[model samples]
Target chain A: MSEPIDRKTVESVARLARIDLPEDQIDDTASKLGDVLTYIGQLEQVELPDDVEPFFGAIESVNAIRPDQLTDSVDREQILSNAPDADGEFYQVPPVL
Target chain B: MDLSTLSAAELVKRLSSGELTAESCTESFLERIKDRDSSLNSFVSTAESAISAAQAIDERRSTGQAVGALAGLPVAVKDGICTAGIATTAGSRMLEKFVPAFDATMVKQLLSADAVVIGKTNMDEFAMGSSTENSFFGVTKNPWSDQHVPGGSSGGSAACVAADLAPVSIGSDTGGSIRQPAAFCGITGLKPTYGRVSRFGLIAFASSLDQIGPMARSAEDCGLVMNVISGHDSNDSTSAKNDVPDFTQTLNDSLKGLRIGICKEHFGEGLDSEIESAVNESVKVLESLGAETVEISLPHTPYAVATYYVIAPCEASSNLARFDGVRYTHRAATAKDLTEMYCQSRAEGFGEEVKKRIMLGTYALSSGYYDAYYLKASKVRRMIKHDYDSAFEKVDLILGPTTPTTAFKIGEHTQNALAMYLADIYTVSANLAGVPAISIPCGLTSAGMPVGLQLQARSFDEASLLRVAHQFQLQTDWHTRRPNA
Candidate 1:
């Protein structure tokens, strides 16, 4: 049986998603998730065929394919326009120290 | 005249034959956007460059240069896809300033095929929320109804297409982003088998689950765009090496003898009664078209949302780590240290929905809970896939409501995260199973909102799915209906 999702877990998820959620909303998310989980739990009761292979997120290739020939690309300014911070051609970041 | 209501294939022919000039078509759309975009808020950024490009294409065509498949056919892109010299905000404040110098692989493919790039459509920030309300820019209203949501994170693409602001648009789906919106907006959308299209320039959300696909007015148009962008790419190692098919070529194929599976699990409790009827009616239409309907059971369907919630956020958390203030996103006005800067930048850049997902994902992968949550979800995902494989053995395709309901009022599900996620209940399994799926308008809901029926097929079987959809489309005028302006 699947366990009930709780407020703590919801808060944890909120933090992971990087949204700042008020503590008040945590319980709501958990309870709602619990209901959804309950709905999904019904599937566990059903039997699956024996020959089925597990579904993976699409397929993966050993080596990424690319054209062998070199080609000139667009300038860096065009790529960096949306960057929050940039210095010349490269993205700018705080010093590691 | 509603220039936005024209189909891409039709527009392509008109432009090629000199019946319609690229400049005129571009101006018509620009005029439409000017007149209508304020109410729908579908576009984030319009491409002035595209107009010039269309003009240039016209010049080349006059000089005897061959016009490509999509020549002068305008298409919008979701905000998440990087466009050369265009803002690719991903609907988050984090990349609010970030722009890409190079085009994404899919964008390049469109350009090479002479597809006119129109503008960037809005979406849920980082494709996190199921409703466009999660966008930092504010919610995109459904064109069908001002009070309803367009669905997300590709809601902008769907809404814009539905409103006829653009002939077609490109969108990404990580758990039904494109399909759900297409369903909500009453248009056509395809989520090709994962890796069917290259992911080179798409910002990673759930890296494993994210895929770029076509959204358009009809199945044939989706196939046209799919043909140009579905090939494997070197930039994305996970892309399939399968031969790209001429999708439109098979659009008119007979649906005779096709086997479509109707999943009992999908229609169980939680589905809107109206949506169920719409889908059932569609299945009936397909049956009348000569395709056989078989009842199939994927008992594991229920577990998909649970499995998806765990997996998508976990992957999202990992992928989003690159956006630390020090790295790329918004930085605090004053941060005492690097760690604080990272936290604050993230806190400010991400919308509430995005943050919730990240936190859920991070906790799922955290030290003590990894096996219990992340690993368990992975296992469940595998089981879900297996169920699909088994079902496909008996049927050629699966039919269901792309969403459990029509587009809900914008604020209806925002207060309830679970309810919002449930909207994707009928659509997410395809992402987990890595199969191709399409959503086509079937009927209008009682509220006058468009209802979409989702059709899914086995991996690499897009031709079969499109053929059936096209056949159904030919018989019914659902796909041809445009929202009244």
Candidate 2:
């Protein structure tokens, strides 16, 4: 907590988020993110109660499984029409290899 | 004077009694939007079919056919909620061109109730920032003074109602998004309990914390909107199975028996003296109505903003992963492969705050720091929830200032990250605990801007919350004040 976060951490984390952080923004973005993290670091000061479950928002429901039935879905054409590159029934994407 | 200045209840009565045709009412609002939106920048886009839809409603009502409860009501909706044919941009370029194929559950409910969609109001991109300045469309100026912000992510929704562009509007709240904006704009907004309203079509910001609710000129108007919007949805599993109540039926509930709590943690150092007096004055008005106030302490409150920032972003990073340049959203044309496309699309699509949060989330959930950050934050979240749980045992509602100060000038805090996050200090605890809360204008600051008094209630207790808010509104005229726009 004593050390401010560095630019390398921002780049790696942005990569983890699948975002390309612009080179010019790295220094400023890292400094700001470091300040926020330092602010968030206050969480480290409090003692957490035992067995704190993973929060899934306000609703207490976890993995709310329902009957697996085929319900009406959005029309296929309507769904495809929104894709940036649609190939008839499927979304067309760049080559994997 | 124009019909745009009329209240929602008056508009509804006139529409139902045939004193005002639906088309004329819709046109009046559209005209207001045309006249003021250029200056306020509240709307992202207006519905082209609004006039014709209003005409249809008028025709149905005249022919003695059945019309819904919201017959002919013109309402503005935040852009984050999906509207079948309208663009559902969450103020992010990523979904800027994305037109939803279906109406969100709440929007569908509004349509069935005969409400007309006036337009999609502007918002912070993905409902992220505390000010609407983060929007891709452009900043929505505060209606009270063009120099200040109309608090955000739901900034546009609050401004629309405050400026009379619409009688009421729908807005989504993740952390103070709805209430803060409503406070900043001198209006009424409610953040219903987590499961109180269906989130089937609200664009996900933090799935666990996000909820859709109404913002209007009065709590009674918000209650009418809530009656249509709140209920269980099969499409959303986390939605409560409880039957929705008639919110309008509860407004007449007396304030005499209620015990509202005063959280001392909220009054200490960071609060502005002006907002403090305004909140103290609101307590007097409530007490005059026979309500009692008690002292309560939320010991864990100091850690709430820290907990929310950590927890919300972790959820956001995971939720926003769907924007991979493949289906339904913006895509970068220059990418040569799938991975490059994913990286490029999001980088270009999201604004600075969105990306910052996403990265922060990715880091917190990363292997080395997961236990130290996300896990610890989650546990602290429970501690915060426990504080509210214990407090609720002694009181029916908790009262505080919605914001530390009045609507600040735009760009004032945009450069300061921690300062921006600190603004939600008083409002985020309700979201962290999944409770219902509201913001109502109680007084004006010396600078002549509105000051909002916030009240929080236990989960699923919006009926009591709205009732108390309604009772308070009747005793004061703060909610009646409109911006010069």
Candidate 3:
């Protein structure tokens, strides 16, 4: 198996994912993550053809753009209705400054 | 006659003939949900608008106005699909109170077809787990056995149909999410070809793999729903441009001289002995119906689970990034800064399984690990797709068991994530290959739990998949068996 994911790496990943994991769960999280990585490490052993292309999505016609035109939009009140904190028209967020 | 016992197709004939009113049919389902859903926990929210809609259909029919295909049929939709003014939580706490301002494209189609929207069903949180145990609401119990899990993230959709709470329900499948649950609950589930059904309103799990499908009592019932839902939509760019065909037209067609491929890889290693026997028996029934079966090889099948784990998480990590505190519901109250608010809100909102996948996906797509994990897995995905493409050259359909075993008890695999992930081994390849597949109940295990026989056809070939499944249901009584619950 490849090197096990260390707690430091797990912590860094949580930071990158923007999830605030608690300190005590770090080691447990790292172990679980390592288990998954080890399971997926089997892919490294397969010899792939160098010419093969990496697939990002299914094969279908691309650039399916529609003609630009004005269309009906959802009501402004309905759109903001689900916001946790909305000022009737605008969503409220923590001040960046 | 009990309206709940009739299939969607049967209900359509009755409603059209004026033997039963849509209002009465809607009332029966609402009454059943009230009586039974307390034990099953299949529904997240029931719609009062469903009754009003059914009443409108009755009014139209009495006034001699033409109604749509599924006039008056009450159908449940999985919570992941947005409904205008209805709470679509996706079984997660993060969107506990979030209601969409507009209906999902498919929901709009369902409404236009004049079907009553009964309620939103439960599922795995963010469509993440193999069992419904991961839902923030609570685990959905299998209709066959309350102690066992209804396989997820479309568990509620499957369970509701099996329990006769709804004649048909809509589900979204990423990796076997629809089929596995259908197998566990003893019903029919279809995962249409990728982009066959528009995903405009579906909460993204793995955008490349996620496809909304139909779950119902029989293949014919599934086909009826498929007819209404499968079509092109300008809103979903990935939605196929292929013309929608009448899926039920070939239900009675002879399967004589059809070539069915039996992949050796699907039947070996870790598969339950009872399930193996049942699936083998299903092949015999198909052969007896005048179809020929041949042994085929999908050598890269072993890599599907691993490749899916890498690819799905990578997409999910990106898709879920929109759940930050700036938009929709759930914000951290104690955060003093912008970054802290984002972090703390997500940490509190998402469940354990969702957090684990997010982290795994973040690690895989990290700057240094990109080539080693995400890109490598993508190449392997191509090989998996090629395996299906080459096999289809020699056969019309590929057959296999839907899951390795029947439904296990709730909390069985919650502690071990890898074990839970393996439950999708037989179901993921079709998703990775972007093909149409269906799961129909074939037999019951020694414990009386149901086993699903899966049939996969070439991409955009749901017509063939539905035809074959319909024929099999006609020959066997398996799909007719109902749980004692």
TM-score of each: 0.92, 0.98, 0.99
Kindly list the per-residue Cα lDDT of model 2 for residues B384-476, writing each as its tens digit: 888999999999999999989888889999888788777888999999999999999999988889999999998999998899889999999
- The C-alpha stretches of model 3 lying farther than 4 A from their native spots are none
Model 3 has fnat of 0.73
State the C-alpha lDDT per candidate: 0.83, 0.91, 0.92
Q: Is candidate 1 or candidate 3 better by lDDT?
A: 3
> What DockQ do the predictions score, one after another?
0.38, 0.73, 0.76
Report, to 2 decimal places, the DockQ of model 3: 0.76
Residue A25 lDDT, candidate 2, scale 0-100: 90
Specify the CAPRI tier of model 1.
acceptable
Stretches off by above 4 angstroms in model 2 are A50-54
Error of 3 at B71 (Å): 0.1
lDDT string for model 3 (B1-485, tens) is 78888989999999999999999999999999999999899999999888889999999999999899999999999999999988999999899999999899999999999999999999999999888899999989999999999999899999999999999999999999999999999999999999899999999999999999999989999999999999999999899988989999988889999999999999999999999999999999999988899999998999999999999999999999999977778888999888999999999999998999999999999999999999999999888888998999999999999999899888888789999999999999999989999999999998999999999999988988898899899889898899984
Top model by TM-score, which number? 3
TM-score of model 3 (CA atoms): 0.99
Runs in model 1 deviating more than 4 A are A1-56, A60-97
